[model samples]
Target: MLDLARERQGGVSDYRIAQLLGLKPNQISMYRHTAVKPSNPVAIRLAELCDLDPATVVAWVNIERATTPEDRLAWEIILKRLAPQKRLKQAA
Candidate 1:
């Protein structure tokens, strides 16, 4: 989510994102730095606000939540299953 926000056009500021999430700027900083876990609701809101796939974003959240290598590998496999295509086709 943080990477997506940074890669967005105009590059959304953490302060702006925090304001959008109704959270303190430092909280956003924590999330950015991985000092603490992010709330799923906030992550979903961020994904929606960024016009990203909520399911895909949630999959990423699940990956982040995994504490063990085996668990992370399972989530990675699930994500790969979910995204069998190399890329989404462009609209005509």
Candidate 2:
């Protein structure tokens, strides 16, 4: 997610992204390092900053955070249904 943000539309620094997301720079760094997952609102805003679909991004994040098989499956289904066709094609 941060990768996308950094690579898109010229580019953005972690500090700039933090400012845009109303978070601290260390939080963005932690999220980039996989030491922490952004909360849903942060994830959505990050996706928006990256020119991504918030619903798809949130669904993907939920899948990664899911604890049970059923929970994961539900999020996967939602992601599959909500993600753009171009993104689905890229994944395939």
Q: Rate the local accuracy (lDDT) of all candidates.
A: 0.75, 0.84
lDDT of 2 by residue, 1-92 (tens): 78788777358687888898999999987887774678899989989989887888898888888889999999998877775775766899
- The parts of candidate 2 lying over 4 Å away from their true place are 84-92
Query: How well is each residue in 1-92 modelled by candidate 1, as lDDT tens digits?
Result: 67676556257788887887778999988886775767778878778777787666777887888899999898888778767542553322
TM-scores of the candidates in the order shown: 0.67, 0.81
Assess the local accuracy of residue 25 in candidate 2 as a C-alpha lDDT between 0 and 100.
Answer: 94
